[model samples]
Target: MNLQVLQQLGMSERDITLYLALFQLGPSSIRDIASHTGINRGTTYEALKQMAARGLISYAPKGKRRFFRAEEPDKLLELAEEKRASLEQTIDSLKTEIIPGLHHLKPEFSSGNVRFYEGDDGIEFVLKDILATVGKLEEKTYSVFSTKSIRHHLYRPFPNYTAQRIKQKINVRVIALGEGGEDAEYSERKWLKTDGQVDASYIAIYPPKVAMISMASENYPVATVIESPDIARAQQVVFEALWRFL
Candidate 1:
């Protein structure tokens, strides 16, 4: 069997070894398990305790001694479902309790907090941050100065970004530098003349944060997220002015 998959499902090396040994030698004692797996008796006992606690194994007394056996294979699926439900509960707690408490500790109007991200995955991180921070307010909108260069970089990593944004009901106003972008629901686009100068950079103006993405790097894509209300407002004003002119 693929032991690595058991490890991925939160089983430790000792646990996997002991479980496999138990499966092979059905209704075995601790001495038999240790002898089969070449593990020390004390460690084997501890692993058996843990596995039994997790419902992966069970034991029943046979006269003066007890024999341990692996639970039905279907129990592994039940254990995985339990882990998934636990993880969902943790995520909910972090969102409702932990994250807001941490936010409260942040200084108001602090020096521009800038974070750098690299590669395609990093670019997707920045985009997801925008979607998550905007919340679900119908009137909330953000502005963007999008270029063809950055679009090419982002399209592959986040092909469904626009569809996800629309699904979340977030609105955007964009100024496309150097042509060709379609109008979508909850989004407005206008073209800008690059005048034979394509900078290969994109700017997104979301309140309290402004993101600048550079697709000019030959090696990989890069993104910078600046968290400063003043800077974001300034960029928004510039985008609005250009929006009016276009």
Candidate 2:
């Protein structure tokens, strides 16, 4: 069975090894469990102590020593629930306490911030951020500079992106760098002719932030997000001028 979920629940490799060993060894002393798992006695004891603390393993008195055994696997659900509760409380503290305290850390003139993302998961984050950022705006519209070369690749990470955009009532204006893009609700498109497919890149001009996505290699995508109102505004101005000319 895949016990990888134990790692997600904060169990180290040694802890898992020991916990599983206890099931095989049946209520084992720390020394026997350590010998079975090939871990040192001290480390195995500490790991078992932590597991006991997490309620993943239970110990009982046996003669002069304690014997350890894995709790029923059902305890994993309890552990997961506890983790979720802790995360929710942490979220509350971040919003109500930590973030307010962190405001003083910002400089008088904040410089542009840039972040990089790679692969499908990273691309999904950028796309979700776009919808979230634009949705919070007084103007729920943004512009895109898309190339045919990368057009197919852009939404692969977020196939339902347009659906989400429309659901959120967010609109997009596109300056397609080459032919072939579809029309959708709350969107306008204009094409820019090129000799052929140039470099595969896409740029989105969202106020206060800009996202640039491109192909690093065949079927490989990378993205960069620049959080700067000035840069976003500059790109908007250029896009508007070209939009009118087109």
TM-score of each: 0.71, 0.64
Candidate 1, lDDT over the whole model: 0.86
lDDT of 1 by residue, 101-168 (tens): 99888887555488999998998899998898775435668888888766778756888999989998
The number of clashing residue pairs in model 2 is 0
What is the C-alpha local distance difference test score of each model?
0.86, 0.89
Q: Which candidate comes out best when scored by lDDT? A: 2
Per-residue lDDT of 33 in model 2: 87
The reply for model 1, stretches above 4 Å from the true place, is 1-10, 13-17, 20-26, 35-42, 53-66, 69-92, 110-112, 135-140, 154-160, 166-169, 183-186, 215-220
Q: Candidate 2: where is the Cα deviation over 4 Å?
A: 72-74, 100-104, 113-132, 135-140, 145-170, 176-186, 191-203, 210-226, 230-246
Candidate 2 lDDT, 1-246, residue by residue in tens: 987778878987777778788778898898898888889989888888888898888999989999888899899998888989999999999999899888667653444378999999999999999999999999899999998888788889899999999999999999998788899999999988999677999999998899999988999999999888788999999999999999
